[model samples]
Target: MKKIIIIIITLVLFGSCKKDEPAPIVVPIITSINPIQGNPDTEIAINGSGFSTVVSENIVKFNGVVAKVSSATSSTLIAKVPISSGSGLVEVSTSKGSANGPSFTYIPDIFVGGIESNGSKFVGKYWKNGVAVNVTNGTNNVTIYSIAVSGNDVYLAGYETVGSVKVAKYWKNGIENILSDQSKDAFCYSIAIDGTDVYVAGSEFNGNQYVAKYWKNGISVSLTNGQVSAEAHGIAISDGNVYVTGQEALPAGPLVAKYWKNGIATSLTDGKYDASAWSIVVSGNDIYISGYEDNGVNYARYWKNGLTNALSYNGNNIVDQIDQIVVSGSDVYVAGRQSKTALYWKNGIAVPLTNGSNLSFAHSIFLYGSDIFVAGNEFNGTAKVGKYWKNGSAVNLTNGFFDCSPWGIIVR
Candidate 1:
């Protein structure tokens, strides 16, 4: 009887211990889902609470597609969108119940044609069969002055003034990146891309004069501090050296056109009125810089090897700027505006894109293989329309509502 009573007591104690065990943890709740449907390569952001120690494995997928978690916060997760083509619906599962987001459309692959220049705006568009297609509009709010292309990525340089302050900005793959934090003023006039690094050249104001400044990988480099009040207008990368061109202050209170190889200043012109370098080209060991000289009149010009190339003089008046340069086999091509008309030169032969009455100006040039593309604006009596030319034939790309223009072009 005593042994039976002891065994029963032991069993009762074990059952009581089992009944007192701790309960399972309750999963945190997800509050909201935003941009539920996203295209491939797009980032999807998820918001919730109690995500303090969230891991990639914690991210569950009901659709079976692998989603890469890019970043995570205490209450949010940034994940790379999967190749969800058919139906854009995605269901996310976790230790808690599943949550679903709506379907989103995929962004189509764009074939880059090359960059083109309008006077103040640089426009990039896709071209097919010698015609412009899918031209980006609403570019007047921001000016695209110059462009550089590497692979399918395109970079732009320019400045936009919001009220009294000018801000230097650039765009990569069509996404805008502001380089300056100044509430005063800044401008990026030229852009160059070497491998994956992007560089820009321009000027930043320092009280009285504009200081020469450039950026490498979005980092600033001031070639001229505040001493001489220099300006950097063009930038190019050849071999391994970075070349920039513009004007420097002189003792006589005028600017002299100059270029720097890896920041080593080299004077290309010594004129007093206003000498500026707008574009640069490199061929083998030869470096060519183009702009205009304000002697008695504004003349389109360029220089090679510190010596003036005979082709520098294009016989234009009151207006001239070389916004871009490209080397074709053994020939060189330069594009800019000459006296309110779009102008291009190949091997020293000047070709006008429009009559002076059109008030058109080409700010950039692109040569893909044997084809050439130009971007700018077309004046139609009352307003200017954004336009791109493939093979010298003009095609309007935007309506005249906001004076849009193509500033950059690339062919991929």
Candidate 2:
């Protein structure tokens, strides 16, 4: 009888202990994320369960960098992408546990190349998404004429002063690659890249006169015979053929607009008047050149497959020049200045980008999707400012206190 009573008491004690214990906490489960790719500060939505109702208690991260969480609930939350965050998986944490969502990708940035004056020296720089990166060491005067980006590599073509001589060079991600030997004065005005081969077009002083030349993988090829003054201002590579455009000064005549195909010169003008080509582009088998001809007055013009088409009226007392040309699909775009006003021509139709009140010039043009981007400088009363226009809206890249000029732009 005594043993039976003790056994019942022990069973009753065990039942009471089990009833008083608490349940286990459930871990947070991240299910999905919207808009898998974006730039910094982009808001993203996360859906899951077992999250904290309080925003501060929930933690979010992008590629190991902490993201700012604006709001949070048990099943949903909103967070902003962090700056300098690389592409990686996003994770969310709570008091229960942590869970990872889908991977997020960063957008390819925009780059603009130009010259920045620092006190007494001019430095070569390229702005990546509005952040400035110096290409030169700031010891000598340098100018960056053109910029191109392929994959993750950035290439800039320009010239830097070496002692008393100007040396043509190209910079690959801030590392200088010399194209000229400094034996003579040289200038690199344009650059084009094809796989592993790098081409730069410019002019070199050869004893008597400036000779138009280009360098392929650091090997020099003369486009001119070194007999008269000539210059190669633009370069493009398509279908394994190299094309360059510039002006060739005849013995007693005017500078003629000319283009070279694989080192063979073809005249675009009759050389009866002064003319020069500043930019060139090749699409399919058609070649487009942007330039100006002095027919009593300067007039902006472009040639399509060697057929000249004027962008502005001839002898209209409007000084104009086309500095860059780009083609997208069947549309042709040219950037330049018309009577001190920035403008771009699309299929020979002029679209004014700036008012005629202030002096502005567009030096480079790029197309991304349906958006057009132009880079150049604008005079803000006291100083020239570096800026770029996206779909005709201007965005200043530098403060107006300093003199800066954006000569090239590339959006990826």
Local distance difference test, each candidate:
0.67, 0.89
Per-residue lDDT of candidate 1, residues 47-135 (tens digit): 77544355663563414566777766667766766543323445555665455554444432222233344445544444333355423
Q: How many residue pairs clash in each candidate?
A: 23, 0
Q: Candidate 2 versus the native: TM-score?
A: 0.76
Query: What TM-score would each prediction reach against the true structure?
Result: 0.64, 0.76
* Top of the candidates by lDDT: 2
Q: Quote the lDDT for 6 in model 1.
A: 98
Name the best candidate (by TM-score).
2
Q: Give residue 11's lDDT in candidate 2 (0 to 100).
A: 97
Report the error of model 1 at residue 29, Å. 56
Runs in model 1 lying further than 4 Å from the true structure: 1-141, 310-319
